[model samples]
Target: MMIKAIQLLVAVFGVLNLNGIECRKSRILNSFEYTAINCRVHSASIVDFGGVGDGKTDNTKAFQKAVNHLRQYASDGGAQLFVPAGKWLTGSFNLTSHFTLYLQRDALLLASQDVKTWPVVSPLPSYGHGRDAAGGRYISLIFGTNLTDVVITGANGTIDGQGVLWWQQFHKKKLKYTRPYLIEIMHSDKIQISNLTFVNSPSWNVHPVYSSNIIIQGITILAPVTSPNTDGINPDSCTNTRIEDTYIVSGDDCIAVKSGWDEYGIRYGMPTKHLIIRKLTCTSPYSAAIALGSEMSGGIQDVRAQDITAIHTESGVRIKTAIGRGGYVKNVYVKGMNLHTMKWVFWITGNYGSHADTHYDPKALPEIEGINFRDVVAENVTMAGRMQGISGDTFTGICISNVTIGMAKKGKKYPWGCEDVKGISSGVVPRPCNLLVDQGEGIVGMCDIPADSSAIDAMELKKCSYIG
Candidate 1:
């Protein structure tokens, strides 16, 4: 009888162990299934479709043909187009859904400098006219619309926009329409752009507008300090996006988050929400390391950024908007930021850029609330903070905690400037402007604001596997 009891006990324990193994297997299987659903198995090479990367050959037709040929595989298992090492000159080209454009290490994709190569497309309906002028705009060099599961990635390949000509035209007032961006993904979902180097973009470097589920990582963008409007990685009207591990030396804001421009944005009514930005290093002597608005009217909410380092940047965190912008910027939380030689560590301006048109109502007032900055350290800062808000619509719920800033020897005469804002300050060095109420002593240095859990959960992204 004792022997029989021992056997039964062994059998029961064996069943429990099997149950544990099954649970672990289920988790592993779920992870693998998720990756398989997003993975692309089809592959092809650009050279197969008569692509010549000799720096002089216009590969526009070749690229179009290759993409067209790969459309057949989209329904099967998606396709990847591999670009070998060489300088490839091409104009604007459209990307299909479930497509991947992968560049080899030594490859340089050069945008054609000829004006005729770029076609003029209609301005965004949100912005009644082109941003620079009053007509259609030039299409982006690498443009996509209504595409899903599209990725522009490589082993740190380069895309040279050769934008000196466009910059000269803009400076000379010789352009008829707004300049084109280097990469613009519009109305798309499940987009990934990673491991690429962008140089000399005509306008913004990477713009993901009206899109969702975007992941931009391990990108290096470089532009001249004097270049115009070369903002890096603008996520406009996008949701559930993650931008991380990016290094930018930009002419404008290193990372500008926007919804739309003034009245047009108000009518379009799409908000940029649930964005996660981390591990970004930037140098923008002429602009902010990260800026919001000045064109935000549709609304911006639930933005969380951390682990940022800014060197020689004009402003660390800037919020720009005017009275005509009728949107709300709320629940922005930033932490773990380090800045050196910045004009202002924190800046919020009520009167900044002009509205897109006269249709914007002057009295439409923007709402700025729940802006939190914590665990920030700055050295050689010209000014600690400059907070400005509209008179009647004073920016409310602004919180600054655990911030320490060391002023430069020749820093601004006033370390802190405040106009019409209301908030609380805790454990901030150099004190703060009188505008912010001191929220006791022990409450300082503690971050009670919960992070956006949804954005954090989306960070479990898998890297693309290349078969070429």
Candidate 2:
């Protein structure tokens, strides 16, 4: 269902109720304002803390001091820090609880190029090691941990991460730690990051890990197409999150839904479940529009995505896993997608071939089931589908319906490459492989979106604003 102005807040998640009407519904999620954090009692500008926005001054201490001064009002109706219209050069700064950081229209937050500006933090317990190295990693530019009710919003302001040097260091293997992300919040709840432009990120644009009840909306992220690991949005081991009305052009996957790496993830047992993504526009020639994981050992379930648009992307959706990843991906539904200049329309692989360490158990097989895709249209496709599953542990319970794919002039002769996978397709163009046999009308209600009512159905966003 599409409304003229509505911002969804999912505290609990399962699936959307749009079945056959998924594609026909209107898309109008960008017309409204949704606030996860209410107005604060105290508000102060960065200049009040002796902050100079001269684009060369080190504003790290000023930012930290501003946050420290307003933190006392957390219980006294919270506080907000305002960044005026200027260039503020700063390093990594920790956010406080019950706080909001707002940037004016022309304001810019520039990440320092000095390595010392970034503090090193230990690797996530689930990841076991830094993604790019063996030891601790650099903290994000805007970081917070174990906090609640935080908002980082702006009036289309920009956050620029000077990442060319980091990219060069990574390519030369000179980095001893993982690159920093633009923004990251860990073990937090009721978080909102909206209405901002992020560019040239060293790594992921926004990363929410071990968090819940999060909302990310109306954001634009851009990076060089060849920049390594500059993912748009990554939600790791999170729950009940909603990402909507976002545009991204990146080197990596636009949205990478992850849990953790191999054995560490299984031991942590914190799955990323019950998430919703809608109204997304992505462009990444080398990566999928939305990827389900090469690091999902902690398991993933109840993910629903719809109203997606991709251009010059690798694939519309891809599920990646290996034998050592002993997690399960189930109850996933995607619908209402429009793709252009894609490689393969759909892809799933069990031979992802990347692991956290050598200590992983080879016998640990990931379970993939109950995946459904429908109401999609794609043009300029190279191949239709590349469905490869584990030899013995075949992926099952997949359903595709009401889809149309137009092949390019040099498209593959064999549009569908099937392996150890089985599914059913109805009303699909170019016909699927023998594994996914045509079901015609028999596929009715077989790929229905999972539906159940929880506290998320009852939750509604309240209107909030600031006068100062």
Candidate 3:
């Protein structure tokens, strides 16, 4: 009887085990049934389609073969094109949706230096703001279009733009080489770029324009200090961006948030919105740790920057706009920034010299509204200038709060008083009320009163730490 009972128990357990195995297999099959296939390549041993992997690399056909293979075998959907560990020298590569470029540890995708070798695609005319030192039209290096769910990820790797040749040209002229950016994502959505190093870009290192839900994190960009227009990251007319834990030591603005230019702005009709820049460090920068304008004619809104740490940067925080550039900057907040040295620790300058001798008339330009700065601790500043709440045709609804700064005096004595407040045309008057200085010895010097009584609400200074 005991033997019979044991046999029955074994049969029951066997049935349960069979059911579990069947369930597991069904799940695996379901996962495989609904997933996109991937195209994988080991970069180290890849000989171009010409079958020449002699290490003296001509990556043109090799990379084309990989891309073509992915295109052909891309399943019913798209595939992830994989690049394994090795150095791959290639020309310009285009990207598409349902595709990913994954680099493994110790991978190097080096850009070919020969300009003619790069295939040309007539992109929209760039947002032409100022001439670069390179003296040519701006071009982007890695250009993509209308792609979705694209990602560039790896453990250890680099994307070298070979911009030293381009930087040399920048020294001669300024507005040259309307060529390539290190990485350009255009008219794409859901793009993610992380965990890589971008070195020496011809133009802005990572340029993402006309995109949505973009993310860039855990990356390092190293560009020459004199490399003109080598902006670390320029997110133009993008939305829902989260850039975090990225290190940028560039010659120009570390992260410039801009829309298109005058006509370009209208055509794009897309503002850079819902941006969160956190845990970012700027070692060397020409402008603010995070800046706006110079091309903000398209308008920007719903942006927040926090937990920023900067060293040896020029401007701690800056927002600039010229006269002719008509746009609105609103719903912005900045906090938890630690800046060491800056020319203007906190600068909000309008009248951006759009036209020479046109003069800075605040009454004529569009208003910059809803700007807030709080919980910022800054030190080693030579000049702490505040150009806030200057009324032009469009200046209203701006505020600065909870700023603690340590001023570093330069050879030129710091200005004792504030700049003119009379809408630019009223000459220059020091207005008080909206301008608030919590900790600093700076004083608001001589000023003229505006004919409009409401203009007095434009400036304020409170909780002075420095007795200037």
Q: Find the candidate with the highest lDDT and give its number.
A: 2
State residue 434's C-alpha deviation in candidate 3, in Å: 7.0
Better structure of 2 and 3 per lDDT: 2
Worst 10 residues of 3 by lDDT: 27-36
Question: Which candidate, 1 or 3, has the higher lDDT?
Answer: 1
Model 3: number of backbone collisions? 45
The whole-model lDDT of each prediction reads 0.84, 0.86, 0.60
Write one digit per residue (lDDT tens) for candidate 2, span 428-448: 998999899789854565566
lDDT of 1 by residue, 1-468 (tens): 322343353345442232221111111111111121256666655655556777899998878877877777778778777786778899988899988888878889999999987999998876777877889899998999998888888778999999899999999989999999999999998888988999999989999999998899899999997899999999999999989999999899999999988888999999999988999999999999999987889999988899999999999999999989999899998998999999999999999867787789887899999999989999999999999999898999899988899999999888999999999988889899878887856683454447327743554555455543
Expressed as tens digits, the lDDT of each residue in 1-468 for candidate 3 is 322343343345441232221111111110101111222221111221222322247576666655555454234444444344456677676666655565546677777777767654443443433334223344454557887766666564788888877676666654234657888898897777877898888778898888887778788998877677778888888887888889999888899998865544544556777777889999665667788876676788877788899888877666777665566677777767888877766667775654312332333354476666555677776665556434434454444444566667561254222443222111111212223332232323211111232211222212211000
Q: Residue 444 of model 2: what lDDT? A: 60
Residue 104 CA error for candidate 2 (Å)? Answer: 1.3
Residue 238 CA displacement from its true place in model 2, Å: 0.5
TM-score leaderboard ranking: 2, 1, 3
Angstrom error at residue 117, model 1 = 1.1
lDDT value for model 2: 0.86
TM-score of model 1 vs. true structure: 0.90
TM-score-wise, the better of 1 and 3 is 1
Q: What is the lDDT of residue 268 in candidate 3?
A: 51
